[model samples]
Target: MNDSSVGQAGKAATVSARISPAGGLDILSRNEVARLRDVSGSGLHGLLRRCALAVLTSGNISDDPGSMFELFPDFDIQVLQQDRGIKIELTHAPAQAFVDGQIIRGINELLMAVMRDIVYVSTQLEQGGFDLDDSVGITHAVFEILRNARTLRPHVDPNLVVCWGGHSISREEYDYTKAVGYQLGLRGMDICTGCGPGAMKGPMKGATIAHAKQRRRNNRYIGITEPGIIAAESPNPIVNQLVIMPDIEKRLEAFVRMGHGIIVFPGGVGTAEEILYLLGILLHPDNAGIPFPLIFTGPKQSAAYFEQIDRFLRLTLGDEVAQHYQIVVDDPAMVARAMVRGIDKVRNHRLDNKDAFFFNWALNIPLAFQQPFRPTHSAMRELSIRHGRPRHELAADLRRAFSGIVAGNVKDEGVRAIREGGPFDIDGDKDIMQALDALLQAFVVQHRMKLPGGTAYEPCYRVRAG
Candidate 1:
């Protein structure tokens, strides 16, 4: 890594250009800009700086948010107020985010998106305009966030495939994701992901090739990330459409709401969290009959990995949970074929019900699945992953447990928690805990936890799934 202090990260040439909002953020009040600039520790300035740096350093290929901070410790972004519109100014921005001393057009647009959502969310949070306490209200918040970003396109079909997988993945597994995406793209499917590296980038990379072959114009590579995750996983260049949700909960909600189907690639805790979230919702009686397609696939060598995951799910959630997703190994062709057929079902169901194609409005997600889960020390301890309760509720707590681990593993706050409190203690049903322990150990052994070339992996939690 090049060692440049924030003092010399980028060439110092100030450019002032007025840009209008493409979709939602054309105008903002002076009061809003002042609040965003409220850099007084409690304000949004510092958080905004971190997220903007992540976008500026898109395709940086590093999972460590600290590294980016270290490289550009002096970096800062400010919203310039004007009568007609807004102007974004960057100080000591990452040199790569710009070309020829001018910020890339895509990056510029993405940076504005950051400003738009952050401002809107901050306004809502302070004003109490969003009833985040209620489940339906929380879902509405998610929808409004996406709508404000102009992400939901009307009159479109169910073609967006949300691919969930690890940023740290095996080369073989990554290749498999590309191949699967290639097949999906050839069939006129678009790609959506957490929008980072590894599996996230692979499908988009593959689809670009297939999209070109089909001469598909105006194809979308959508990347949805929250402020917490964007730091660790910057948006890959292939993401033409980028939306940064306010938090992880909304980000997950946006995924299920926007995509037609979901494809799971090899991943770590974050991927596991996604699986649990989807399973929790799908297992709900309301969502049982919904024809949503969920699949878990990897290269032949990854059979053992998926086997471990499947075992854990069956033990914890029940064997019936297997009814929600398919296990396809070593067959990208089969993976793509299954998703195509699955989406066809989604289309037929949506058509029969007169639902929107661009977004799945019919999937019934409970409020527990919609509320933002802040992983504090007490929150981690309160998670009830025991047996005998409703299956969907258990899945929600289980999802939060994994999410806490993910936050600790990569997200800044979770990392800070680990540094102060050691690893989070996860206690639950004995058999389920054992299954989760084995699955997590396998992930560590496979180097699926963190970006390579760093310190050795450490267990972030004690799993007592007895």
Candidate 2:
């Protein structure tokens, strides 16, 4: 195998060996193999390798993708065409991914998920004659992505609850999430999340116990991640089904499309990013009557945290935005009960409207929201977070601003940009900027921006009051 390394230090540590794929990605046509192996332009070989490496490093808590690349820069993956099926060829893979010389089955499965999504998106939508120009085309793309990943469950009822939270959280807050998840589990609801640590792992962990007691054998704990954040936040072991989307936009789309309801646990910027994303969509005039349930909950200690988020939302997006989500602190049972009731409404709405339970095909997602946000310096600067226009449109712009902050906080590209230039400057209406700055500063002070006990988190973004 020719040498392949992400950096100079990673060159010598590269390895070359043939490793087989697990379940969903077993068979491969010659054309499919060619698509995976092709490097010049049309192939998804490089993307596949990056995602696979992130899977191989599962359970790692580092939030810096660059560090992982620095350690295994020479790592590469190839899809080999086998008569029985497809085999994975690894070069310079990490030793941690294996135990007693046998690669962990979960890691293998997750790697297959990476390959599954990459190949499907590239061959089917990106180049395979799928029109992505219109709103309907974009929604179709989202549905197709989940379908190929085997994430859609047509036979199942509308009980999948998507949990949105930060990957970095406190011990008490994380424990509270587990408690809430247990209650949701007792009610027989499935779990879905970004599949990282902190609040995401807590609920999945607690649900396992409730599922055991309830004798629910078929439990679905799904994790959806994008390449940019995967290396920083490894997939928790509880994720039975893992799907890595090509970009953050698609990743967010997958969450809103497949899940029946949403739960927001106390978290930092990432959590705020999620909150803004859904609120923006729900605020859209077309979706005003939809029955999606959103909850912001935490332990007793986190009441103030959610309160701050609530106040900021009210200040920036207005009071009507609060009508879309409820904040319930320190009560797991109440949170679960509220979610169950809300989901029941969702079921009835879907039934009445003739929408699919497996995927929310009826939900209106503007192409503006579906298209990827690059978070470049210029793009970040250009975001309009001022007060005015439609509330939903303003919410969308605010979501983009936070998204830029999220990228700067942990994403490799955002971090590199900060290093090359300076912080991303966000200028907006005076009151909004002050409120936004206050919320972010509170996050930093609470040590919510990074994993607790690690190095102090730096502000990658600067908020300027215009």
Candidate 3:
């Protein structure tokens, strides 16, 4: 074992030990183990290290990925292939993950999930196992990934609720999310989220108490994230079932497919990106009459936030888009009842259509939404956020615009790009751009753009209303 002190001035102590998998990731081929250990620039070791660190430091409040790395510069993990299956060797792991020198059981399970997903993606998806060039193939790939992770269960009722919101939000909004989650939990619903703090954590936190009160067991608090954003927004500790998709598009797809209903709380660009993604799909001509339920809710203080979001949707996508979701305010019981009713509708629809309760196979997600949008400066500049296009198509572009801003705000690569260049240049239709600008500015003013009390946020993109 190598002894290396990490943290500033060695103030944060570390631990070294070999941990046996808690069951989910007990086996790996020799080649897979080798890939995880390869420390070259083109290898998976660096990616593995980043994700492992994020899991170890679960419940961290910082959105900066670099800060964690800075705190644990010498931390390392190794996958050992043994006849008895596999073991993880940790070097200078965060002391927080350990209690009395033993890694926390929940965190250990999450760490195994990290290794499981990285190895699975490297061996299955990145290789020629699945075609990623077309829409059908991408959807199939997402299904297979969830299946491998054991997230898809047969013979289960449709009770999973997908909650989308900002990781950075106000205290009132956070408490409101928990209240809604509690209400949902009391009704026997599970939760799925982006797996970060603030809104993501609140619902799961609230649900636990409700589940406990109802004596429910094995309630799933699933968290789906991708490599690009996972470090910035680490998986919250409440996520018992965690799956790391290969990219944001797939991660978003996972949420909609696996969830029976969606409840959106107050959030920033990331939440907007999710709302647009779902709205774009629902607005597609082929998806008309689908029974998926979507709700936008918050404390009474967040009424303006939802209003701005609603106005932005109506202005950009037309009033038809507003039909896709309902806005519920301050009443957790009402939100939960509405969600329960919505899930019942979804279940009946699936039964009538002979669809599986576990996945939404009938949703017509266009190739545009399925395709990954890399928020490069050039791509951001090329986005067409204007009128006269198909409403769904326009919604797709708007989603990309917000997605790029989310990247610039928290994603390491996007942040680096802004530092290297300047804020992303987003120029589009005059009216739409103005609405978008106003919405984003409100997020900044409300402290929704970043975690509360971290650092002052500078604009990541300059919106030009043409």
Candidate 4:
């Protein structure tokens, strides 16, 4: 790596370097390279630059998506096609990503992942490689993307656990996540998450220690993210294997289809969106027999948080929805033990059905759940958050409601919309609206809506009980 300090005076310190690709991504087609270099509105360069910068500044904590760009105004990345392989050129990149002018190995690989996924999605998925219009095609696309990233491990028993929680969380809750991860690691389980800070990083961090102590090698710490959320929550350093899905919908599907079990920590609307997405699928009549383990756990202090989630879920989706998940508060050991037992069942079920252990191909996901729901103000108002619809269908729309709030809170496009058109209007059944309003109020009070110490959060959506 050839790098030089381009920072002068009090400006943000940065380095310029040309480094070889790492982590098996050594080549790119000329067309792909050109597309990555293109700076037009239709080109993939903007997406590439944003995601590359996010990984380059891996440990920074700021929810504002544009802050990084504002801080590093001159940063730019270009793919240089070479006779040997591809080389990445960095201009005014974050100095922290380097030590003695050498790029950090993990960040380098993650940067490669960013390039790999962006190029794949733009050239392959969008260029008639995937029939994104249909449900099966979308699932197939997801599988192919993960396969391309080399994330699928064949012949391995079901052990990958997808942990979902808010980046913005309390210290106690974050530590509790680490403890649970430590136990899961001790049992030889791998960790997968959104690849951000706080809850997403905690399990992976704890698992590293356990893996080291247990003499476990070739352990996987996977982090799955999409382009929109990556800027707000940069990928944490603990993620050894990083995969970027095409969209939020695909990202959620990847979690359910890839992992044997899911452990949800206390979080905000983003976490709520994940819960509704999974439960909605599990509640489907076809998926009723599936033995996927869903556990909601946090420290004792989070009992009330779980209670609020429980009430909202029960009221909206009916009492039977609770059958899909188990709630265990204040016990990391119990959570790990329960997850282990649940994965055992999942393994057996996969065997009985002749399904692969690496991917849950037997599970049914409807087109509604698979399709991306862009949260424009109009779309937010159109969501049918009512009582009498089928439980699964209602859960899908309710998931959209929270998903819209998540977009409003973090995504750049959604934030600009909210700024221009005022907070999104979420109107629904009187009881459901009241419940949703109360839940969001609690998130605000607990500082779960944004990273702590940031500017006070303004309401991005207004709830109305119609």
Candidate 5:
């Protein structure tokens, strides 16, 4: 293995080593390697470096992507082509990923995943393997990405529960998430989460123990994230399988399509965005009678939080929307029991319809939900969050509204946009806007918007109720 000394920042030691891919990602063509090495404006080098750094610093909590760059200013990664295989060379890499001069096995696996996804997405998706414009095309692309990552397994019973919640959560809420995960794990259910910290980590952590007790081997803790958010929320160490989707919309679609059920804990705008996205799709007439179970859950103290969310959903989407999900509070056992029952129904439904258990091919996701929403000022302002529209359409707009807030809060480009153009302006129906504003204010007041003890979070959007 070739090694060279790279300069380091003050007191932060770095390492340089050539390491082989740990997770069956050894083969790479010359063109693929060139794309990864290319540092030009159109190349994938910068994206690869940023994502690699995120993988190296897994479990280290810091929401600021810029800060990570500053901390490891000299860090570099290169994909070296060899006659036998490919070798990943790291320069000034994070020392924490190494223990006693060897990289941790889990981190190495994740690093390979990062490289695998980056190379695959650049070559396959961007270079015409899939058309990303049409709705069906996008879905096919999503399926292809997941399939390439080996995420979809056939003949598996429907037990993957997608856990949605904020990375910034209270200690009690975090524990509650673990409790729910423990219950789920005890029932042989696997987990799929956005896979950062707090709620994301808690469930996987709890499930690990329960899986151990049950002697459940090869239990999947799947983490799906995108490039825009990966830097802000680094993957937790608990993520056994990680797939980085091309964008947030695809990531959300992956969650709903892959998991049999979804359980939402208290979260900020991002979680709200996820909730709206799923509810919007479920509300579609085409999706009616689908057995995709969704549950809103939290600890006893978080009852008010779910109450507010429920009230907002009812007010905006009508009471009928409640049928799509059930709210469970302070009852981990009940959550798991409900999930098991739900999964049984999902299994029966999929069998009756002859659908695949690993992927939901029957769910009809509208084109609006598939297309990426750029959270520019004008785009945010033009969202039609009025009650006069169809409930699903209204939910779609509201989801975009919250998505904009989430982008402004954590995404690098959105933060830069806010710094350049001030907060995004969101104008909509009077009652809906008032409810939206109140919910956001509560998120801020409860320290849900940003990680606790970080700098005070300024509003990223101005709500103008018509």
Candidate 6:
């Protein structure tokens, strides 16, 4: 790494450096390098800059997506072609990413991952290699992306646990997530998350120590994220393997497809969105036979929070929805034990069905879930969160509703649109609307809507009953 530091008269300290690609990526075609250099509004430079900045400033605490850009206004990256491979050139990068005139190895790897994913996905789409129009085609695209990232382990058993929760969680809730993670690590389980702090980081944090205690090596700490959410939930430092999906829908699909099980911790609309996505897929008649272990857990203080979620799910999706998940409060050991048992069943089922251990190909995800929802105001207003429809169908729209709120709360485009057009209006069945409103209100009261020290969270969507 070549490093140069300059402290502007009245700006954040800046560093300029050129670094070779780390292990996650090494080479890029000349065409790819040209595209990376493109600065047009339609090109990849902006996206690359945003994502690379996020990696360079890992462990950032704020939930505001634009804050990093504001802080490092001149931060930029370029791909330089070389006979051997490629090297990255950064101008005014964050100083923290370097140590003793060298870039941190982990940060360099993550930066390469950002480049690898962006180039591969863009090239594939441009060449018509990805079939995004149909359900099967979309699933294939997801698998291809994971394969490109090398996240799929061919011979591994069912052991990855995807933890989903809000980055803005309570101290108590964060500790509880760690406890569960510790127990999971002790049992030889690997960890995967959205790759942010709070619940996402806690489990990985706890698992690290436990893995050490058990003398486990080559343990995987994977973080799956996308361009839109990466800025808001900057990849936590513990994420050794990071995969950047193209969008939120694909990111969620990656989580379900790659994880053997899931554990939901306390979170706001983002967490709720993840829960609804999985439950909706599991509720599909086609997926009823598939066993994906899901558990919702937290400390004793978080009991009321889980109770609220349980009530909402039961009321909206019916009591049968409870069959998909188990709630374990204040018992990290039991949570881990239950996950292990649940995964054993998953292993047997995979063997019987001849499904790949790395990915859940047997699970059926409809196009409605696979297609990206832009979360425009009109889209939010049109969601059919009512009864009489198939439970899975309703769950899909409900997930979209929460997803929009999450965008408004954190994503750059969603935040910009909300500011221009005002809060989204979400309307559905009277009972469903009331339940949704009550659940959101509780999140605000408990300060789960945003990080504790950040500015107050203004509601991004108004709930209406009709």
lDDT of candidate 3 over 1-466, digit per residue (tens): 1233333314567777788888468888888888899999868999999999999989998878788877788788988888889878888788888876778899999988888888888898557887899999999999999998999999999999999998888899999999999999999999999999999999999999999999999899999999999888888989998899999999999998899999999998999999999999999999999998999999999999999999999999999788899999999999999999999999999999999999999998998998988888999999999999999999899999999998898888889899998999998999988898999999899887864246788999999976
lDDT of 1 at 337: 91
Task: For model 2, name the residue pairs that clash.
Answer: 6-73, 15-92
Clash pairs, candidate 1, are 429-466, 430-465, 430-466, 431-466, 433-465, 434-465
* Weakest lDDT window of 10 consecutive positions for candidate 5: 1-10
Rank list by TM-score:
4, 6, 5, 3, 1, 2
For residues 1-466, could you state the per-residue lDDT of candidate 2 as single tens digits? Answer: 1222221335433334566777567887788789788887657776677677778877777777767677887777787787788778777787676654567787888888887777777777646555677878777777787888888988678999999887777889889999999999999999999998888898999999999999999799999999888877888888989988778877898999999999998788877878888898998889879999999999999999988999999998999899999999899999999999999999999889988888987778877778888978899999888887788788788888888888987787888898898899999999999999999999989877863237788788889987
lDDT of 6 at 49: 94
What TM-score would candidate 3 get against the native?
0.97
Using lDDT, give the best candidate's number.
4
TM-score of each predicted structure versus truth = 0.93, 0.93, 0.97, 0.98, 0.98, 0.98
The positional error of residue 277 in candidate 3, measured at the CA in angstroms, is 0.4
Every candidate's CA RMSD:
3.4, 3.5, 2.0, 1.2, 1.4, 1.3
Cα error, candidate 4, residue 331 (Å): 0.8
Q: Sort all candidates by lDDT, best to worst.
A: 4, 6, 5, 3, 1, 2
Off by over 4 Å in 4: 6-10, 451-453
| TM-score-superior candidate, 3 or 5 | 5
Task: Point out the higher-scoring one by lDDT: 1 or 3.
Answer: 3
**Which lDDT values do the candidates have, in the order given?**
0.85, 0.83, 0.90, 0.92, 0.91, 0.92
Which runs in model 3 stand beyond 4 Å of their true positions?
Answer: 1-9, 451-453
lDDT of 4 by residue, 238-343 (tens): 9989998989999999999999999999999999999999999999999988899999999999999999999999999999999989999999999999999999
Score candidate 2 by lDDT.
Answer: 0.83
Cα deviation at 231, candidate 1, in Å, is 0.6
TM-score of model number 6: 0.98
Give the C-alpha lDDT of model 3.
0.90
TM-score, candidate 2, is 0.93
